[model samples]
Target: MSAAPHTPAPKNLGRTALICAGVAMGMTGLSFAAVPLYDMFCKATGFGGTPMTGTAGAGKVLDRTMAVRFDANVAPGLGWTFTPESPDISLRVGETKTVFYKITNKSSRASTGIASYNIAPEKGAAYFVKIQCFCFTEHTLQPGESLEAPVVFYIDPEIAGNRELDGMKAITLSYTYFASKAGQPLAQGGTAPAKGDAATSNL
Candidate 1:
């Protein structure tokens, strides 16, 4: 005998479709929320070598010291020269120090750029605090203009106690400059070009 008329297709196909639609909407919402969620996570956990943001604290200095190196880069076609005035520095944790990054508008036309940065040995990111930095700010320079932007920072003495970061002798701070898209024309939903390829450094 023929198998009982082949089992009929799902009687609740419409319900299945509705469930799928719900899932799709859920994923869409998550995609939109992902950026801010990621930013919050980085600020909280220091994941992916992301650093913490805060102002100066106790200003207490430790006997133990670590080496810190500065790195810089410019996006392609940005027509700018970017470099750290200081190649490297050694300082005690909790000691606030300032460093400069020089940027020159090499193009005849004025240019604008913004910076983004991260630290290496990702685990140490949580402890690399920047009391002041030029990152996230638009740096607009007149044709042939050159300026030195400052970054005043300190290492959290708490880092000396982080088991995950223990045994770390140094940390590298890297930065990249992206062409400013603040006012550039764009397609619908376009976002500012505030990101660039990372140039690693050694501390």
Candidate 2:
């Protein structure tokens, strides 16, 4: 006679189900954590266009000058106009400079926006530093209201020694305003509507 087919014990099946459920939960948590963790890594190493944050200016300045161009943008549903006050400026490698960006709400209703920023020529970003910036913060504006935000930054003097950047004469600093709600950027990832008034929030 043929042997009877073996079946998994009830307890074993339950344990297998629990293990699979745990794996699914772990994956979901990782998905939520990926964004913030990537952001932190970029800020720490300037791996992407994200620049390094500093508490103060570079202690020393270099004589070699470089041109820095400013760029600004507003997302489609944000109902805002954003632009850099100055198109471009020159700075010594280690010199600290402050610049302003102008933001105006063109919508009939009040809206909130948060600024995201980055630098161009990825290789050069590692050498760019910011002493102060208005990025990653929420700002709410009434209809037809306007505001001027400032950015303080410098090019690390160490760039002078980086052979790779020897031929780089200019760098671009760009910012994009995205509709925000409850401290989250709606344009990137959020369920909130574009129209809402939010108090100031930080990253």
Candidate 3:
């Protein structure tokens, strides 16, 4: 009894469908790329407590020094006791230093684990650099066996010029060990030593 309803042109309807399809494809691609893109951005800018990686020392040291406290943790089921050789250390900015962490497998069977680390006082992350680290690598230990791993790092001298951190006296470096099935192969491997076996690592 009313006038026939108007219909959209076929061309217009097809165009709208194509636009939606394109948008869906773009969104899917972005979702897949988000993780790696964010990781690259963080590693490059040290955003979100991600420390910068350094290939070598800063080559210039500053008279100003800062204390770095070490904190360690073991995720449940890893059956490992992890501790830093020292509670903390103080060093000049841009001065390269190495610290060791001890990890012992207390379980009755062999176990593999990897470490993840981050810096606290997020503001200082951009200026903190690691020249060498045992993190992100897998280590296997037999029952009652222990491994001493080292981390080499330095605080960028640039921090000395940043007015924002002028009053910051110390930074905390924290690590957590987790069970993992994939990562770089074990750095070193050995069986549980005999009760009186001579040890090859110190600290």
Candidate 4:
């Protein structure tokens, strides 16, 4: 019998090479797209905003003074109460100061929650304020537990010289506690209540 025709290994090899090339191209495209895709994901989840640093001059401006206000709030189901230990307002430029707020759990149930806040005029969110806030992390309180939390923050000196914000006397830094369920902290982006919700306070 004629030697069995040599199997056409080259044909099979060429098809395999094409398949591998397609897969490699696909992977390369995925790698290039990953960064932007991740950025969008973080934005959607609020996972990648400028982090709040509780230091003075972290974002400072030269030759200007900005009045700083410290405001605190609590939500209805937090089973806790909060009050400011220092003057709700102060004046500072290029310097960070710590303000104290007391949190007391009034209910018999253990409560856990986180806090979130924003500055006023929306635009000021970027340069005018810095918060050393507790709600950055979850707080767990036992029944009737009371404790004090401090927020150290400062105003960028630039605000003082900016005519646009010149007359702005106060910027409220408020917090609302949300139930820490499923190990996920509650978020506080909703409209603040006109009156303090049972679980919130504007102190």
Indicate which candidate wins on lDDT: 2
Candidate 1 per-residue lDDT over residues 32-148, each given as its tens digit: 999789877886776777778776563688888898888787767778898898888999988888899999999999877878787887778888888789887888899999999
Candidate 1: list runs displaced more than 4 Å.
1-23, 183-197
- Please report, in order, the local distance difference test score of every candidate based on alpha carbons: 0.79, 0.82, 0.80, 0.59
Candidate 2 vs candidate 4, TM-score winner: 2
Candidate 4: misplaced stretches above 4 Å? 1-66, 129-131, 187-203
What are the per-residue Cα lDDT tens digits for candidate 2 across 11-130?
A: 788889999999999999999999789878888788866788888989998889999988787777889999888989998888899998899999999999987777787677788898
- lDDT winner between 3 and 4, please give it: 3
Give the per-residue lDDT of model 3 (tens digit) for 72-177.
8776677999999998999999999999999999999998997766777777879889889997788989999999999999999999788988999888887877
- Would you list the rank order by lDDT, best first? 2, 3, 1, 4
Instruction: Give residue 67's lDDT in candidate 3 (0 to 100).
Output: 93
Over 4 Å off, model 2: 2-18, 188-203
Q: Tens digit of lDDT per residue, candidate 4, span 1-203?
A: 67777765575888899999999999999999996687455323323222234344455434444555555666656667877786465555666667787888888988886665545444454444445567546778898898888777766665555688666665555555566665444434534332223232222
What's the CA error at residue 2 for candidate 4, in Å? 44
Residue ranges of candidate 3 with Cα displaced over 4 Å: 1-9, 181-203
Worst lDDT 10-window in candidate 4: 194-203
